[model samples]
Target: MSSTPANPPTALHEVWLIRHGETQWSLSGQHTGSTDIALTDHGRAQARALAPRLATQSFDAVWSSPMARAIETCELAGLGGQRVIVQDLHEWDYGIYEGRTTPEIRASVPGWSVWDSPVPKGESLLQIQARAEAVVARLLAASGRVAIFSHAHFLRALAGCWMGGAAALGAHLYLDTASISLLGFDHESRAIRRWNS
Candidate 1:
């Protein structure tokens, strides 16, 4: 009788990409893009708490946004040793909308979607989405689990890139600081597996 290889049950590796904990802007619903900002005291505590959780999993690679908030989270989570800085993973540059609430933007733009409307002086969604796809392609070529710490908007965009296309969909994925999310293979293909989870 011919035999088929048994299902591996799981990929040999898994990536646990965690969005950095909340910043002042996050708590207030402001668009925090490339701006360099520090974590609030509560944000620091959240990062600290992530330490134990991180210790439980061993990653082949640990990466963080060059941004202070993300790097700080990685360090506080006890993952500072092998951290690699990935510029492509930085948050979406909110440009003129930086630190502003959606309602405020709507007040001026009238039905403008961040996904559709271009933020003055910032990279467009296409640019951000392309960067994300590159990162995912790199990861897929690598041979082990990884840990990535990053910001909200970009991470959401990255999630979209991971799924295939249309980074605009990232606008829908809500992530919590210090929260863990997973991406892995399902049936010989890439699948979200879990999100903002």
Candidate 2:
């Protein structure tokens, strides 16, 4: 029996990745991982700004990292009632690098980068990738539009994984605070619809 070349690619759900707004550590360029910090005043304003943009679309589900920053952003973005906390969405565990800036880390090890360098006593890139992949799997299984509010590094990792790339690919995805990104299928292939908006 002959069959059509592979069936047409199934349309995938759309995912909106939202990076939490500005925080003291975010502004200061600190690692800010696993620190559970809150958003700054301007950060709150930034989150409020998201409400209008997000209101344009209706999401089937809204997810947030357990961190205060992500939770607050989700709430301020007018999704608090629908926000579901996902631990896997939390920021990378910086460990020894926690609260340290890239410049500070590079002072000792020149050109050190989180994507390539080892995170001593902390989650490795592989570990972060696993979490990201897990979350991606869940999103793929779900229907309709989904929104996630999380930290920068983790969200970048998730984006990379969503595109079937390694976590290190996040090195090239420059995410700004309070930015929104969209991920969905491009015809038959997984693609980034819009990014860093």
Candidate 3:
């Protein structure tokens, strides 16, 4: 009798990253870090619309930042019941730059960018990268599909880290509010299957 292959190839794992719906600060182009903000009506609708798409897939785990906007989006997306709060998933601390837009900040310091410039008392790019790496490690250690609800900057950083790139690489990936992205393997190499959808 022929025997089955002993070492079967395992299925590719996926990490689905979801950015929280829009908030007033997000709309105003403000740096909203460590701020407890609620979503707008349109943002709520955006979150609700994600449910159908999410329902199409079976996630082995669901995670969300402790921030209200992220948590609310998880709830509206119909995955709140299964979500585990991850404080490290919170947005990068903007420090004194909090509530100020890049342009506004640039008014004083020409061409200031969170990705390129340092925010006084805020999280450094390296610091945020470390957090992203930690999350990526956790997800990689787990089996099957996973989902995460978080903010824009943090999600971008996570995507960069997933691809084995520095968090500064996030500056090249533009993510919209309430968007969906996928991180998976490409023939044994980590890859971004989809982005900012």
Residue ranges of candidate 2 with Cα displaced over 4 Å:
1-11
Global fold similarity of model 2 (TM-score): 0.93
TM-score of candidate 1 relative to the true fold: 0.90
Which of candidates 1 and 3 reaches a greater TM-score? 3
Q: Write the per-residue lDDT of candidate 2 for residues 92-176, one digit (tens) a residue.
A: 9998999999999999989888998899999999999999988977887777789999989999999888776567778889899
Query: What digit string (tens of lDDT, one per residue) describes model 1 on residues 1-197?
Result: 11111223153367787888778988898888877888999999999999988898878899899999999999999999989998877888888888899999999899877788878887788888888878877776665678999987777787776665658778778788778888766655565777876
lDDT of 3 by residue, 75-122 (tens): 999999999999889999999999999888999999999997989999
RMSD of 1: 4.6
Clashing pairs in model 1, backbone N/Cα/C closer than 3 A: none
Off by over 4 Å in 1: 1-12
Give lDDT: candidate 2, residue 109. 84
Regions more than 4 Å wrong, model 3: 1-12
The local lDDT score (0 to 100) that residue 72 gets in candidate 1 is 94
How many Å off is the CA of 196 in candidate 3? 0.9
